[model samples]
Target: MKKHQWMATLLSLICTGLGMFYIGTPGMIIGGMLLMALQGAALFIFFMTLGYLGLIIGPLAIGIHIIGLIIPVLYFSYRSPRKPMFDEKRRRQLSSPWKIVVRTIIGLALFAGSIYAGYTWGSAPFMKTAAEKREVQEAAESYLEQKYNEPFKVTDVDYTWAIGSYNLTAHPEKAPELEFTLSSNDASPPAISNDTYLNQLWGQQLRDRLKPLLDELYPDQAFGEAYVFAGSDTVERDYSRLANNADGDVSQNVRLIVFADLTADNLAQEKERVLELIRRLPSVTVPGETDLTIDYYAADLKTPESVKKVEQDIDDMKGKTSTYSFRVFDISDITSADDIEIRGLE
Candidate 1:
């Protein structure tokens, strides 16, 4: 074999160009290195095209070397098949470099076009849908404030639509109206009479017991009509009713529902009263299992000043009863009277 050919083969085998240096073809050495880079890129693309299993690695290795060898050989054949090898031939006598540059530019332009199209056409609608949710929440909150003379700092909201499947021959003109449905925790319907009445009574009794406890804890705050639910079914029903927007055929939209209300001017006093009530309310004690952290006693007491007193009362109660804990959420800013207008069928 020719000295340059022998060197090219060795360098291509070792990773292109190392053997070319031994043969003394500076031009062929550069071409061999370029071939090696192209071979590596082809192997990577091949793996990506396949499911990326290691099975393709063998074929990729063979294919890459073959292409690398053929390209340089073809270039040499065209340049000077009769040249007495390396030192006599100039490296720059090979193929045009401008072609490679043009192809690279085209590839980059295609990639950028795809990215722009995906952003504008494929992904923009989903972003708009997400933004719509925030707008719906704000609108629902505003509506509640206007309707009930109270601001509903809506803590939560959700919606679900009715589904339908039509037959192949279904009339296209008879399409149903697109309806909106709003659901929330506060708008849950009340349970059947027998399922929750007894528990309701128990809840009231617990509240009665708590009234005196609150009085003892904070003498300044007066306890108002405290609503309590004993059974989970009723509570669940009420919560669901509060959350669901049963109005209109769609029965879905935004539900700015209210859970509790305290008709008192002293927001701080009411908060303290509620907190004391929560702390004093009796709970079903389960031995050796602290996982059942029962804090069912909650009152939506509004106003910052009264809220402080409520916190102080909780601290005092904790000192007296170390085993108990409570979740004091602020529903004070929510006093919406806007009823969740229910459908007759619902």
Candidate 2:
């Protein structure tokens, strides 16, 4: 039986290398199996990674699909099937309108089925219902409380499919800002890390403690968002971040991004104000090894976009944050603002 290239290509269009069955040559059958296997592997990975692996697997699957669509165009050695497909003896008589219509319906059904499978199996795992989210939240809360022997609250449960776990934002009853991230996927045990919780805890405390100091020094709100972070030592030793430690390098270290506005009008005045602030920073009791990114903007030029990203928005600024921002200036990682020596300015 002569193979129909159009029939094979159309079948393969619905599924990669599906047309090979119609052609039925040994080489075609082998190629079809390999391409089909590749498609299956891609599907498995897409499910396992919860769709993140799609980008990595897309090209390979697409390449196979493309090949399946176009490969029928090239001439191949045609062979008869072991059991004659469609009963070649009755080919002419069964070429009636009803037979043709039935075949068309079957083809359409196949195409539709492929699409349905793609949606149902591929997406169903990642999408959870509200009840499922609530269940996960309860489970995570229970796990955290038992693990730490402390009362905790689960604010929300969110499934991050990229990592295949439900990420829970939770906090101890006493301190909400000192929140911890816990993950669960129901199959394995709920995972919680003390290291992550402690780091977040210390960072929150440092930020809170620094705010009052800023209020006293720069009373007119001269400073902006101060991302105060503690080093690994603070996380490990579990030191109270709020405690005043004059120790040079113990636990507290700030891998910090802070915004300090230049108060003066002219450039010279701005330099002087910045220098003064730099001199005063040492006295401010920021102990341990500290690195600072002090983004400087003009006091007058401070927009919601301009200063600290979103400390103040004079333009009816309540929630107009998350807008695109250009850097007013980039003085990042200046450990000692006093140690800065600009050749031209100096």
Candidate 3:
């Protein structure tokens, strides 16, 4: 039977190369299938890393598939019917009976796998019953209490079946909501400790104080966002180090990251404003800490000249007697304006 051109075009449009298979164009069929697979993989990656704006594979994949679909439709529509759609010589080289059968089986298997993956991705979140959610909440609560010595209750549990993880949000009587994730294995505990509580409180206080000042100073250019870090070390080693050195007097290192659209014109004025703010900053009192070693960060001063001037200004300020150690940072090293880090306090 002569293959219908429109049918072939429709099939290809639906599934990259299915139309080629219907037209007995085995070589085109294989190519189309491969292209479809590649598009599917790209889409999967896009969905997986959707949080990152840089990972834009999803749109590219869609474009590629659209082009792929268009190419075959144009070829079938314009090609001379007398010349034949299936290349007999190419078919002999690429698509023997066994080869075609194997390819078909592989394609079916992959299609089934994709369907199964989609089903799992769609159903995993809704699959958890009331009893299962209760169990997960109990486990999370116990884990939190055992780890942090806090009386936290699991208020919400969110399951991401695609990643095989659970995002559990808990609430303490007098504290903010604490969020943690648990994987299927639950091999490692959620990355939270006593310092988490301290950092949260410290950050809130710092933001409340600094935000108003920033708004007042640079109403037009200020972001009014401060990335506050209040700890001596990374959270991973915090609990372990504290356990080993229970009596050690560790001074918490606090960092405040403020954003402003600084330019050459206002550079000097902005630098002086930042210095004055640093001088006026209230001492953050943490356990075993009298004063905070505050580091100020701003991204707008990216040019080498601006950075040098800022550093020089800070050094000149440091030359005089000061109550707290002050450091200035250019935003080049920071990935985001909101990113904050504390290496060690003392």
Candidate 4:
């Protein structure tokens, strides 16, 4: 049979080095087949290493295929004319039948392996175990329950095995308005910090206890909202201690940040009312801790000038000793009404 140069070139374009086999060029055929095998293997490995490894192997596989395509085209164009097409001398120089068969088999095997590898990588994300799916759902439900103080149902868990991550959709019974979808790769949900948990628990208790009294005292609700935070006093100590090795005798501090819409007219009256409210608060005692150092901050959100003045007053009192234990600040200058960072005070 006559070997057509154009047909060989077209085959090479379709499949790297395939044209060389048709053209009866042993050297070009071997080189093209090797390039094709390398490209296939690189692609398979790239899919297997989906995350960061893809960053490396992905480019390598692409480069191999590009080189494979170019090499075959160049070989066909440059060497085809010099070598006799279907002459008896050229036929004698062509590879033996057994050697061609062996090379073809090896190349086919490599190609098949690469395709299988890619298929496995693509399907991995959808092939998560039932137990893994359940774990992801449970994590989402647990997080929602802790956050909203209600029962939560995880509706769906989408596990992506390739990336080793999962996304969960949950619905809180009490809080229907809130979106409770959570995503993570961790085996379990993150633990709540001891200090934060304690602060939130104690804060809720304080709010429940003081709500009625506060409502009666301030009928007009001039005090916007009183949020009390209870946590261990990390400051007021000359020395530092590691979080795990914290001192037991360290005092527990209760800070009542009162958000009040105070104008120049009712500033003094509101300040007095806050002080009275503080005085009425019963001393709280926690086990294995010194007395609670209760402090107050009356945030004046009415005007910027009033806020600035209060800020200056706090600044002046920073180094000086005060007769009163509870302190107050006009946080009008602060944009967020919820911000009440007074613990930084000396």
Candidate 5:
């Protein structure tokens, strides 16, 4: 077929470098194929990285499209190819404008199909369809109602790629903050992303018990963050869900992290007090192996950022930056207390 200029221009306009395909010259054909390969690679990378590569790939793809747009315009107007598009034998095919339009339509349809295929392959694993989302929501709702005896609504299902699970946001009908953070793999019951449910099972009671013991010891400073861990096991997400009955969370093995402020003068005394509190933990919760750490920080550097600055300042200040103020410690797997290690006191 004798390729027309307008058909070449139209194809390039919509399908990018595809116009070069119609130009029927060796250089143009090869250039069009190269552009096609580049565009395909860009699209695949964009999908695999979850669209993180869009900033770079987007501009490169558009630049290729612009080249496709200009190729036909420049060639037809300037005789830039300087060669006939088709030989006598090749020109025997259809030259009808209707047939040309039909060919263009077919090319466009194929291009669109390729795009849809790429999207399905790249994103389907990372997102849930409407029916799948609803299924996750229903599973979470049923699990919560049966376990907690409270009406819970599934608000949203977010696919967390890092953990490889679809985390469903389920909240009590009354309070949005009480999220159950239920997650599902579609093959089985959903796991919890947080401990709101476990708090009811035992975490809350433990928290309530720990607070009073710390109050008696320091009587003023509040706890920072608290965790109840099972003996030598660290998996926390599978604990209390009715469908998962994982007994790791039900174990009495626990650890406590406390923050305190003290100077060289009272460091030893405070350590003994914290150890006494750990000894008293048996009265409040079930007995099992435990780890207790008192993070001693300078009293004045209470904010996390400030304490972090001082912790890092030792390279320049030779450990003097937090000598008078700060917290202690990360003692683990213990019957606990601290030994006197006060320096720079004199």
Candidate 6:
């Protein structure tokens, strides 16, 4: 190859400035040196502990690549006289433009492939259907029991996964929805009639079905009574949500609520559900007269010693707390009550 060709080849190799160095261009060398310095600074920022901050600045990467290109070109332009410095053989070998193009293409392809591999590995689904099936089977076994030595089959056990609960058909067009059952070992029988007993029984069945999922997912939290929205049941509506005060210094304080439907059946089922939920939560306790209270603190900020101190303080002040009493309103006769007047006021 000719000397000029060798110089050109070297120029191409450098992509602009380094190639000019092979041809002995002093200006090109200086420009390449400056570019290298800039690249060095960018590289330092990119690899340093403060790389995150560097990215936010967003200039380091562009500076490095721009310098890489500009330095080589500037070198060739300034050192035009050195173009003839290279041997014919070197020139011929370096002049192969195809080789440079192929290398660039290969480098880009490799970069893209690496990105796709990383995303695929990081986003693969972790949960297996087999494990889910097993969990459902175990839940079914726990929900049923024999009555009077008669075997009971858990007719069906269904699974639904969602962020929150809402009634739905396990299968479309299904009727006579399977209900939840909640039971209690309270020795005294509730003063409930057959009709109310059946309704409460339905609610209980739903509770039983939900127990396993709740126990597994929310180990630290307990659910209160299932406030079902039965038709025209105003009392049930009020019980579903009572006013909560946020301005109090206690973080919580007692508030009295009055409800219109205080039937024996509703009271028994609601009580059973609330009690069962509290029993599931390890440290939670429901003051019988009040529906619920903050009995335990599992907060990250509260240390064990702090919790003990708070508990001791509560115990010491228990006797002086008669000013606050919680009344869970379960009134039965509001729908039938009305004010009556015999004469118009003058």
Highest-scoring model, TM-score: 5
**Model 6 C-alpha lDDT per residue in residues 101-146, reported as the tens digit of each score:** 4433443343345334433433223212445434443333232221
lDDT digits (tens) for residues 1-346 of candidate 5: 5677787887898786667766655566667666665666667677889888899989988987888889877866763235556444334344456765655565555556556666777776676678867777787788778766778898888776656777766678866644445567655455544424553334445655667776787654435223444432233333333123433333443333233456557667865765676568666654433444334444554456544543333122233333332233332233545432333322
- List lDDT for all candidates, in order: 0.35, 0.53, 0.48, 0.48, 0.57, 0.33
Ranking by TM-score: 5, 2, 3, 4, 6, 1
Clashes of 5: 12
Residue 199 of candidate 3: its Cα lDDT? Answer: 46
How do all models score by TM-score? Answer: 0.23, 0.47, 0.40, 0.36, 0.50, 0.24
Which lDDT tens digits does candidate 4 get at residues 76-101? 45534464664455545544666555
Lowest lDDT sum, 10 consecutive residues, model 3, at: 316-325
Model 3 lDDT on a 0 to 1 scale: 0.48
Model 1: lowest-lDDT 10 consecutive positions = 164-173
Native RMSD of candidate 2 (Å): 9.2
* Model 4, global lDDT: 0.48
Query: In candidate 2, what are the lDDT values of residues 158-180, reduced to their tens digit?
Result: 77766767777888887775566
Pairs that collide in candidate 3 are: none
Q: Rank candidates, lDDT, best first.
A: 5, 2, 4, 3, 1, 6
* Pairs in steric clash, model 2: none
**Local error of candidate 5 at residue 250 (angstroms):** 4.7
The reply for model 3, stretches above 4 Å from the true place, is 1-3, 20-138, 145-185, 188-195, 209-265, 282-346
**Residue 32 miss distance in model 1 (angstroms):** 23
Clashes by residue pair, model 4: none
Q: What does the lDDT come to for candidate 1?
A: 0.35
